[model samples]
Target: MNRRDNAPGASADIGAALYGLATRAARRLPRDMSLTSAATLATLDRTGPRRITDLAAVEGITQPAMTTLVRVMEKSGLVERRGDASDKRVTLVCLTEAGASYVRTRRQAGVHAFERLISELTGDEVEALVAALPALKHLADLESQDREGQNQ
Candidate 1:
């Protein structure tokens, strides 16, 4: 039997469709930026400076792995490390201006790509997608809450 036959609600169908679209969209993105690097940059840009441990947690990576990733990003001029003023023992990682600009450029490129694809969709399909976005966001929030609960 088809999996959709076992699924309930338009939400499930929409979610699966969106997931497929996102997978294809990610494949279409420029090869210059890795998804992890883009995610790190976007997180830093949105949240400002963070300790390496915190960054690792946000990125869902091991501390040592995050350390290595940060070092690689540092070498590429995307991030900089500075001493935390209040906690002299702790170091804060932040995006350089170049990193922020790079993230913005990549985001714009992704948006443009999506917009082009969206433009091809019928008006009713676009309306359906727009209507689904709020529920999708809520689902994401629910999943995050579930993770947090599990962690605690």
Candidate 2:
């Protein structure tokens, strides 16, 4: 058996290594867009329209901070707000067509960055990365669900 299999802190070590690899690839991408903006757009794309409060919670930021981000995105013509039909007091933020296109652009850049990294890896490593994608997505979904449950 590998020494890691018997180590008490092996899981954390592995997690850190994987996180480092992802961070490295992310760092290679252009810094034209802030991470917060990309994350906000990505969240809206994944979850559809959401109230400002909900978006703040999902993004793990203060409601006021999210409001500021929304204002900036609105000014950039990437998002728009409308009063909730069921609750006039609440406002929902939705991505504009431009915003969706921006997300696609940002996603493609990240994909290209990772693809470059993949080119440096062996065939077996690339296969392992592909196999791990589903599990990574599941982990992400579960973590978000857990946070939402806590917020409620």
Candidate 3:
């Protein structure tokens, strides 16, 4: 039997709607940045400086690719490499002030887009989305935990 036929409680509809919402909101946002660069900047902002190998694992990209990305970001003055205090042989990728500001602007653009979308929604619709916030955060936490488990 098809999985959709199995239960009324399935999240297929929610998944599709959320995906649509996310895609539409993203499309409406004004930005000329690649997702990888945005995500990398956001990661460094969120997690602080980390080794390129660790960044590669977190981003699901190859180390060499991350090295290239870091090089480009460094050239752009978006990031910097530093010696690890505890390990002289290790290098850490850090977000420069410009990089952090860029991440902040990127995040604000997304928030502005979402806020506009929410303003167009009806009161009940907005309330439903507000109610769903906890569940969404829980899902995010689950994903993070799963990623951590994979690293271990």
Which candidate tops TM-score? 3
Model 1 lowest lDDT segment of ten: 143-152
lDDT of each: 0.85, 0.87, 0.85
lDDT ranking, best first? 2, 3, 1
In candidate 2, which residue ranges exceed 4 Å CA deviation? 1-7
Candidate 1 C-alpha lDDT tens digits along 1-152:
86556766866767788799879988887888678777888889977999888777777888898899899999999999999999899999999989999989988999898889899999999998899799878977886677545534
Considering TM-score, which of the candidate structures 2 and 3 is the better prediction for this target? 3
Residue-level lDDT of model 3, residues 1-152, one tens digit each, is 87667777577787888799778866765566666767788889988999999888888889999999899889999999999999999999999999999889888978887787789999999999899899999987897788757755
Task: Show how many residue pairs clash in every candidate, following the order shown.
Answer: 0, 0, 0
Quick one: best lDDT, which candidate? 2
TM-score: model 2 vs. ground truth: 0.83
Residue 74 alpha-carbon offset, candidate 1, angstroms:
1.1
**Model 1, position 60: C-alpha lDDT score:** 80
Per-residue CA lDDT of candidate 2, range 1-92, in tens?
88667888977987898799878877776686777878899889887889988888888889999999999999999999988889999889
In the order shown, the candidates' Cα RMSDs to the true structure are: 4.3, 3.1, 3.3
